[model samples]
Target chain A: AQRVTQPEKLLSVFKGAPVELKCNYSYSGSPELFWYVQYSRQRLQLLLRHISRESIKGFTADLNKGETSFHLKKPFAQEEDSAMYYCALSLMDSSYKLIFGSGTRLLVRP
Target chain B: EAGVTQFPSHSVIEKGQTVTLRCDPISGHDNLYWYRRVMGKEIKFLLHFVKESKQDESGMPNNRFLAERTGGTYSTLKVQPAELEDSGVYFCASSLSKAGGSYYNEQFFGPGTRLTVL
Candidate 1:
């Protein structure tokens, strides 16, 4: 079984400040990690994936096996970045069934 | 191309009433998935369909929930005698199949249907 943990329910940051959303996971096998974002009144969309090693909308995440974490980070936060973010983990044993975290609501105040 | 689309964006009904939600996946996508989120809970997988067949349904809550993708184009999830705990948002996602492959493709999601059972 796989489980995702997002400790923070709410995170606030000022515009132009750096931001980070922490995520941790417990899985016995190799894991595929992803970050999903949902804007107000919008559908959930994939932001980034550990397998791709890419960044989207100035946001990037690095998967650390030693730390059992995948933290999303942005050098400078923008008001548009405020949204609900979920961290998910998937194992091949489960046929790519995603186990999502409870989600963290990010607020960027200008 | 258009993204995945779901019908009956919102529905409200009595406890014993049956509700059916629809999902239209992107054209040419062979993999479809269903998920739901209850209040204060994480979004959990309900099932997965590959074309017209159910590939995986280990996450389905119970027999009260039935899903079908008859023609492999669109799918529907019917919840019979819904309980108060069934009130939540149901999301549908579609992705291209990568069968027998190690990597998985990204899934496109619909806006989701919000069901309220009183």
Candidate 2:
């Protein structure tokens, strides 16, 4: 069974400070990881994916195969970055069926 | 293109009642998915539809939850005799095609319908 774990329930940081949301997964096969964000009154949208190796909204996540971790990070947090972040994992066998982690609520205080 | 859209942004029903949620996928999307997030829980996959056919429903909790995609367009999820545990936000997503390579896996999501069963 594929499972995603997000260790933090809430993370508070000051504006311009670095932010990192920890995520770990347990999967036997190769895993596809993603980060999704949901702002207040907005739909959950894709922020970044490990496969893409690209950053969105200044956020990036690196997938570590050895550690089985895919942590989302940002160099400097902005007030607009405040939102609920969910880490998800998709197995190679499953056709895009994502197993998500309990989200982490990020609060960037101005 | 218009993104995935869900109807009844919010629905409140008492236990034992039935509630139906609708979702309209992107015009040309051939793959659709339904997911839900219970209180303090992670979003979990409920099912997947490829056109009008159910591709995967292994994640469905029970037989009470029935999902259909008629004519390969919009989809509906009906929960009969909704229970207290059914209270959650249901999200719908659509992608171009399941076989269209990895890029096609980028799914656009709906705003979700918040269901509160009292």
Candidate 3:
């Protein structure tokens, strides 16, 4: 079965502190992973994709096929970075359907 | 450029009642998808529409849920004899048509409709 797992329900960090939100997946085929963020009063939006290999909003995630992880990392966290993060897996069949994890709430304290 | 929109941001109804949720995708987007998030659970896919056609609906929970996209435009999801387990946040997303054979596009999501069952 294909599934995405986010171990932490809430991850707290102080401003300027390092932040890491863990995500793991179980799939037999090549997986396409994505990180989505939803801020207060905002719609869920794509933060980054493993395919892009780019950083957005000072956050980056690298896909490790051996470990089956796509953990999101940021060297310095900001107050605005506090939001609900979800790791999702896209089906390889090109259906464009996303399978999401339980999600992790990152709260950056001042 | 408007984003995807869902009607009735919140709805409270008793069990066994019927509710219809509407979703209007961004103008010109051909791929529309429906997802639901139960409390403390992952956001799960419900269905997918490609221009008035049900491209994939394997994610739909059961026969009680029916989704339709008339004229390849806006879509509607109707739940008959709703149950308590149906209560959750329903999200609608839209993306552009696939280019070549790769499906690499951002799916614009709506504000989502929160359904509550009494």
Candidate 4:
């Protein structure tokens, strides 16, 4: 039962507000987590991976093995940050296939 | 370098009709993958190709779907007698294959082809 779950279908927030997009997973093996973003008219791009431990565009995610979560968080939301966010999981093995969550749409209002 | 590209950005075909989708991965990338996303569902992997050989195709749904990557270059996915459930956006991705590395090879995605089965 390997799966990724994004609880919020849509998260609306005003500019300068803190934003959090929840993501949880259920896996039996070592997990490699990633957050991908898709802006309007743009292709999907990797935002950050837990392994990198680096922030991208002021956003960050922390992998909690005990909670089985890798929630994406940003201190302040910007209009440009509005997009579809997907959380993906892959095994630490040789396989490259990704298991994606249903995704969440974040709308940052002015 | 050009990213992965998919042909026929949009396709509309009736049920029982056939449709072929093409993808050209980024040059020099040896790993190519196909994914599909139905309405309201998460994207699911359909297959993977390492050059001209299929590295894994456990996600392919059925026999009506066939994928081929000839000459270890461009690839094609053909759906014969497509059903309503086959309607979705098909995505192609590519990444450089690495040997024994901790750096996660990031996968670049194409714009994707939206297929409609009426």
Q: Second chain TM-score per prediction?
A: 0.97, 0.95, 0.97, 0.96
TM-score of each: 0.97, 0.96, 0.98, 0.98
Ranking by TM-score: 3, 4, 1, 2
Query: Which residue pairs show collisions in model 2?
Result: none
Best TM-score among the predictions, by candidate number: 3
Pick out the ten consecutive residues of candidate 2 chain A with the lowest summed lDDT: A89-98
The number of the candidate with the highest lDDT is 3
- Stretches of model 3 off by over 4 angstroms after superposition: none
Which scores higher on TM-score, 2 or 4?
A: 4
TM-score attained by model 1 = 0.97
Q: What DockQ does each candidate score versus the true complex, computed on alpha carbons?
A: 0.79, 0.69, 0.82, 0.76
Which scores higher on DockQ, 1 or 3? 3
Candidate 2 residue lDDT tens string, B1-118:
6688999999999999999999999999988999999998999999999999998998899999999999999999999989999999999999877563454378789999999999
**Interface RMSD, all models, one decimal each?**
1.3, 1.7, 1.0, 1.2
DockQ class, candidate 3: high
TM-score of candidate 4 to 2 decimals? 0.98
Q: Rank the candidates by DockQ, best first.
A: 3, 1, 4, 2
Tens digit of lDDT per residue, candidate 4, span A5-95?
9999999999999999999999998889999999999999999999999999999999999999999999999999999999999756565
Model 2 docking category: medium
